[model samples]
Structure formats: structure tokens, C-alpha cells
Target: MMVKQYLNDLVSLFFPQTCAGCDVPLAYGEQLICTACWFHLPYTYAHLDSENASARQFWGRVKLEAAASYLYFKEASRVQQIIYHFKYKSRPELGLILGERYGELLKESPPFNRADVIVPVPLHPAKLRKRGYNQSALFAEGLCRAMQIPVAALCLARVKATRSQTQVNRYARHENMLEAFEIRDPEIIGGKHVLLADDVLTTGATIEACASVLLDAGAAKVSAVTIAKAL
Candidate 1:
């Protein structure tokens, strides 16, 4: 045990884990994010209000149980930096850590707590192969750990690999995502309240499409959650 501890200490000395939110070396007890950075995150707490912006964005497009996010993502902000590390920098654990923390908070929020299953938005097979893992699926695993909810990672799939939505107009974004997702293993989603998860909420086209598939598959209700909400 002593030798193992020494080896672990040596590794830490040479390769310290930094806080995802602040890029600072984490204190001994800190995991992914430091306490200070955690306290400062732009939390939306949208779960507290059913009509929060995250939900409102889907108002006319799809029926939902709840739609919310953990943080506000702004360009060059701490939340963005944290997400950047996971989405583009290949730090998939960032998604899991963020989802676990968010799931802890969602325990007190309705519809979210009542969700029988968590379904992460899927990536195209090509993208999944390139990225090595689905960041959303990692987030789903974390939420499953904290919320004691099962995750149906394969219930929904992205059929078409479309262009990036960053440069697309709102109408075009919806069009681009149309028919992009299909329901698989509908038995898992049928008659269950599902909490659909993703990394970010921007135009929300992705979430809308996923929810539509869930509802059509007989999901009693569907709520949307994300690590960040891009405003």
C-alpha cells in the first residue's frame, strides 16, 4: 500500500489534474472542478422554472416534460472552456463529471426526478468512430450513476451526418436535422418518462428531433437537459 501511494504521488507531482472550469491545478480533494469555479459557474437552474428559456425554445416545436441546463455557455467563458476540453480536446470525462453534478441537482427538480430513463442524443457512426466515444453517452452514464436512473444509450440513433449547425440559420438548422434521428429499441422508451440529454442547447434542433422520435415511440413524457445552454 505504501509503495502504491508513493507511485500515485509521484504521478500527481509530474501530471497534476487541473480544474476543468478554471484550468488551475486542483486541490487535493477537488475532482474535475475547483470549489471556487463551481460556485461561480453561470448556473441557469432552469429546472426550477418550467418556462425557462431552454424549455421555451421548444415550446411551439415539441411537447416536453421539462427542458433545462446546468450552466450558461458563452464564448470564451469558463463554461465554454470546460466544454471545449470535453467536446474538442478529447477529455470525455468532463462530460461525465458535469452530468453527475447536474444529476445531483436534478434530484430535487420534478419531471427530471420522475424520469424513468435517460437517453443521450446520439452521434453519427462516423463521428462516433472519429471521436472514439460519444460525449453525450458519457454524460448519460454519469447521470445514471447519480440519479439511479438507467440510460438507454441505443434507443435513439443519428442516421444522417449533417453539416455543422453553427453557421446555419434557425429554419435551416431545423431542416438540416429533420429525419436525422430514428428510434431504436423502442421498448426501452415506450411508456416511460425520458430525460433526453445532450452537451449543449443552441438552436435546439437536435433535441427537438430526438424528443419527437421519443414521443412517437410512445414515451409518456420527455424532458431535455444539457451541460450548458448557449445564449
Candidate 2:
């Protein structure tokens, strides 16, 4: 036990834990984030507006009740660092932390407060196996805990993995994601309001695909929430 404690102390000394966003020294018991940076994180509060910019991204293509993101992701902003840690570093708790923290504000927003279920954009099985966990699902779990809503993990399933949407143009977004997702259970989501969760909204291709599947399965309404908006 003493040897283990010494090893832990050595690791802490070498790593010298700092906030992922601001590089500030973390206090005792703090994880990869710090309290100061956490409070200063930018929030859009777009869900409260009927025609927020994030929701307007899907204007003619898809229908949604409301949508919002917790942060605005700029190229080199702290939000990018947070997302980087959550996405590529295997620190999924960052996603949940942001979701749970954002959930408080979301619960007070109109329409969002009434969502019956939370559905996370599904990752293909191969990708999920490689990543060990899905960031969107982790975010949804946190939102579910904060809102007291149930999380529908497999409501949407990816039929197959596709090439990255980044290299594709605007016109190819929909086609690139064609038949990528399908509803696993229609009965549960039929006629129910759903709050779709994802890590980021970049061109809205993946969300659109997932939303299409859910709507086809008879979901009464579909709204979206994400950690950041990449616009």
C-alpha cells in the first residue's frame, strides 16, 4: 500500500495536473478541468430561441422542435481543447461533465424541458470498438441524469461506417450518410418527443441521418443538443 501511494505521488508530480481548457493548476480532487474555466465556458442558450442559428442550419432539410449547444467551437478556443480531450484522449467523462453542467440550463429552457427521451447519435460498431466508448452516449447519459429523462442508446444504429464527411461538399452531405442509420425499436419512440444528443454539430449530416431514422420510426418530435457548434 505504501509503495502504491508513492507511485501515485510520483505520477502526480510528473503530470502536475492542469485544466484541459485553461492550463490552470487543478485543485485537490479536481479532474482534468478547473472550476474557474468551467464557469467561464461560453454557453449559447440557443434552445430558448425558436429560430436560433444552430436550429436554422436544418431549415429546409429536416424538422426539429429546438436545438442548442453548450459552447461555441472556434479554431483555437478553449472549447476546442475541451472537445479534443473528450474526443481523442479517451476522457469521455469530459463530455458527461459538460452535459450534466449544461443540463441545468437546458432544463429551464422551453420545449427542451419537456423532452420525453434522449437519443444519442450512434457510432458504427467498428468505430465504437476502436474508441471503447461513444462520446455522444456519454453526454446523453449525463443529460438524462440531470433531466430525469430516459436515454435511448440503441434507438438508432449505424448500418455501416462511411468516409469522413469533412472531405465532402455541402451537396454530398445527405448522400454520404445515406442509409447510415436505422431505428432499432420503433414502438418506444413512436409519438414521443426526443432530444438527440451529439458531441458537435458540423454541417449537421450525422444528426440529420439519425433524425431521419427516428422520424421515420414515428417519433412525435425531434430536437437536438450538442456540446459545441462548429460554425
Candidate 3:
């Protein structure tokens, strides 16, 4: 038994599993990120501040109960590295890990703790087919695990694959995505405080497009959450 333990320790030393954010060697209980990196993660905490930029984005476009993003994403930041791994490197588990951590922080905030159900922004069928998974849904699942909330997967639908909003102005994005989303089932969300989740928030165009549909379908109110907010 001692030999087995010794061998395990020797192998761990050679591999020296490290944190994604800080590259510190992880302890036995740690996963992708180490304790230092996890605790020192750069968080946005937008949910704690009602007038944050995240909520302000939907000022006249839609009524949001609250809005927040977990992290601030810059070009070469640690948050960006983690996001890149989760979104593009086939690491679905990373999405779940991030969601759980972020969700815990969100629960301490006012509006988030009262969410009726979580709904991830739906990806277009074509995109889902190509990616083989919805990254936002993975994040939502992680959130649900942390918050003990149910996820309403069918509450929103992506009706069209609109052009990328990155190259367009806010006005152009809204115009282009005007008819991009639809609500398939109003019964699930009627009079409910819905938490709309996504992997990232850039211009908030996609969230707005989907929120408009949910509101039209009788959602009492809509709030937004994302793993990161692109700055």
C-alpha cells in the first residue's frame, strides 16, 4: 500500500498539475484551477451593482430584473484563457466548473437568488450541429447545480442564424437580429422571473433578441447572466 501511494505521489510530481489561471501546482482536491487562482479570480460582480454596465445595456430595449457577468474578459487575460479552453477546446467540464463558481457568487446578490428558472440562450441548430454541444447550456447546467434552480431549456429558441454581431454597430445588430429568436413555450415561463444565461456578453445583442421574445411570450421579467463580459 505504501508503494502504491509513493508511486502516485511520484507521478503527480512529474506531471505537476497546475492551475489554468495562475499555473500554480494544484492540490489533490483541485481540478482545472488551483486554490489561489480560484479564490483570486477576477470577478465582475455586476449583479451586486444595479447600475452596472451589464444592466444598462438593456435600458430601453427590454426590462431586466437584474444582470451580471462573472468575469471581465480582456484579450490575453486569465479569464479569457479559461473561456477559450471551455468554448473551443472541447472542455465541456470547464464550462460547468466556471458556472458553479460564478453561480455561488451570484446567489449572494439580490435578484439572482430569486430567479424562477435559468434559461441559456439557445444556439441556432446549425451551430449546435457543428459544435456538437451548446456551450451556454453547459454553463447553465453548472449554475443550476450550484443554485439548486431548474433550467428551462425550451423557453427560448434561435429562429435564424444571423450574421456575426462583432463587425456591426449596436443599431445594426439590433436590426439584424430583430427576428432572430422565438419562444416555443409560454406556459413554462409565464409570470416567472427568468434568468437568461449565456457564455459571454459582448454588445448584449443576442440576449436582447431572446429577451424580447420571452417578454412577448408572457415572462413576468427577465434577468441576464453570463460567464464573462467582453470589454
Q: Which candidate is the best by lDDT?
A: 1
Q: Model 2, 42-105: lDDT tens per residue?
A: 7787867878888888888888888888888889878998899888988888878888887888
Poorest 10 consecutive residues by lDDT, candidate 1: 170-179
Kindly report the root-mean-square deviation of model 1 from the true structure over all alpha carbons.
1.6
Cα lDDT for residue 80, model 2? 94
Alpha-carbon error at 96 in model 1, in Å?
Answer: 1.6
Report clash pairs, candidate 1: none
Q: Candidate 1, which segments miss by more than 4 Å at Cα?
A: 166-172
Q: Model 2, poorest ten-residue lDDT window? A: 170-179
The TM-score values for the models, in the order shown, are 0.94, 0.90, 0.88
> What's the lDDT for all of these models?
0.90, 0.86, 0.85
* lDDT for position 227 in model 1: 88
Q: 66-97 in candidate 1: lDDT tens per residue?
A: 89999999998899889888988889888888
Misplaced by over 4 Å in model 3 are: 1-18, 22-25, 166-169
Task: Evaluate candidate 3 by giving its C-alpha RMSD to the native, one decimal.
Answer: 2.6
Tell me the deviation in Å of residue 158 in model 3. Answer: 1.4
